[model samples]
Target: MNIPITNSIRHGRRYRQQGMVSTLIALIVLVVSLLAAMALMRSVDTSNTIAGSLTFRQSVLQEAERAYVDAQQKITFTQPTSDADNAPLGYYAEPQPATARSAGDVPNVLVNAVSGSIGSVTPLNSTDNSVTYVVERLCPTSGAATVTACIVPGASLLGATSSNQTSDNLTPFDNGAYAAFRLTVRVNGPKGTTAYVQTILR
Candidate 1:
């Protein structure tokens, strides 16, 4: 009878040891699974952030391009009108009432032009990304040009007389026009990222 009782006690002890080992293994697995889940979450978050930033950058660049195109069209349609009191021959004239040919009722157009000139540094979106742009016109001149100049010696013609003429130090447009205008756009992205784009408008 005593031997049987000792055998039973030994069996109970063995079962408890096995149970403890199983519990330890389960706890270790749970810990490893939690760690993997955390890492995956972090990776997903990082990817999302990158995608959002790229999208914002593209949007800002597109907006800048639209502004540039609108300015070009305005200049083209207005037919190079001189500023009030002939201040200077700027690419963009002052804001005027909407016409049928114009982009009509687009307040953002004026806002973009003003912001670009004044370095207003307005954001592309409400999420802290921003862009600033500048518009400049290159007119043929004889001397002392402000932004860019194309001057021909001994010729009274402006932007003409290519022979012996001083062309703009800047690269001319692909169309080979003696005079062309330019727009410079600078984009600032979140987390200190930035990019620059320049386009020529004739």
Candidate 2:
């Protein structure tokens, strides 16, 4: 009778140990599932953030383009004659190096705009965003847009050898001499977005 009672107690202990092991395995599976869910959620959040940033960047770029067009229109209509710094009108006679506001560098016109002295701040009626532009003549020095000082288009076309024409005889674009101008447009849009757009025109 004593031996039978001892064997029954040992069997009971073995069953309890097996149950504990099963429970522990189940808990581990649950933890793994939870970690996977968290990782997936974080990936989704990162994707959404990237998408939003791209959209905003595109919008600001469009604004910059519109500002560029506005600057071009002003140059076409006004035909400013002075070969000097016309800060009030956002025009520079000499060429400015390609600078970026986002690169910890400041544009000359922005300083003017901030000081309330001179700058062309054109507001876009559609988006209610303000844009600034600087029109710089591509010239070595400022007095006039002469051939010796200014950059003109079709330099390669001027001296082309087509087997029939010599470099000196070839006339490019009907011997037209036009000074190239650089238009730099900066747009300040919603959500603290800034963009720079530049184009060369003749």
Candidate 3:
């Protein structure tokens, strides 16, 4: 005896196989899409963090520069160089020699001024930036005693020509003697950024 399979049964078996394959493809696509979305979000977050840091650094630098200028404006040559007793509230007559650091280096002060006004301490801004400054007269000694000791031109000084050429001429800088002072500013921004600025005014 021999038996033959029916066409309808064969067709139904084929349709079931096709449906299973379609379901598997959909699941795979969903997983890939989820992973891509997550990576994209992380990239965006990283970019935002870097941008915010740069903004903070810029803000702090600007605040520090302002303090440096302010310190110069508030103090004059007549002011004392050292106010050891009052310190921060008063301008230093002679620079604390320990803090007499070279240009671009932090001043070697016993007490670093953060804020408030005694001498050169800058007031805090309405914004988050906090500013402070120190003014140091460029002389080895403090008070009027060192007045002549300061850099004063006698009769000869190498003068600058319009061409800006240097000469060994021994005329003693004829220009009027000018005493210079240093202004150092420290700025603290809202985002934990710090900046230092210094200028020498004659």
**Candidate 3 TM-score to native:** 0.51
**Each prediction's whole-model lDDT (CA):** 0.48, 0.60, 0.54
Instruction: Identify the superior model by lDDT, candidate 1 or candidate 3.
Output: 3
Error of 1 at 11 (Å): 1.9
Residue-level lDDT of model 3, residues 109-195, one tens digit each, is 523653443344344556667666666655556644233444322312223111122234311122322344556666666776666
Estimate TM-scores for all models.
0.48, 0.65, 0.51
Clashing pairs in 1: none
What is the total number of backbone clashes in candidate 1?
A: 0
Indicate the residue-level lDDT of 55 in model 2.
78
- Tens digits of lDDT, candidate 2, 123-195: 6576766677777766566664455445654333223211222244322223233455666766666666666
Q: Candidate 3: misplaced stretches above 4 Å?
A: 1-42, 78-86, 94-103, 108-126, 144-176
Candidate 3 lDDT for residue 51: 94
lDDT of predicted model 1: 0.48
Query: Candidate 1 vs candidate 2: which has greater lDDT?
Result: 2
Relative to the true structure, candidate 1 has a C-alpha RMSD (angstroms) of 11.7
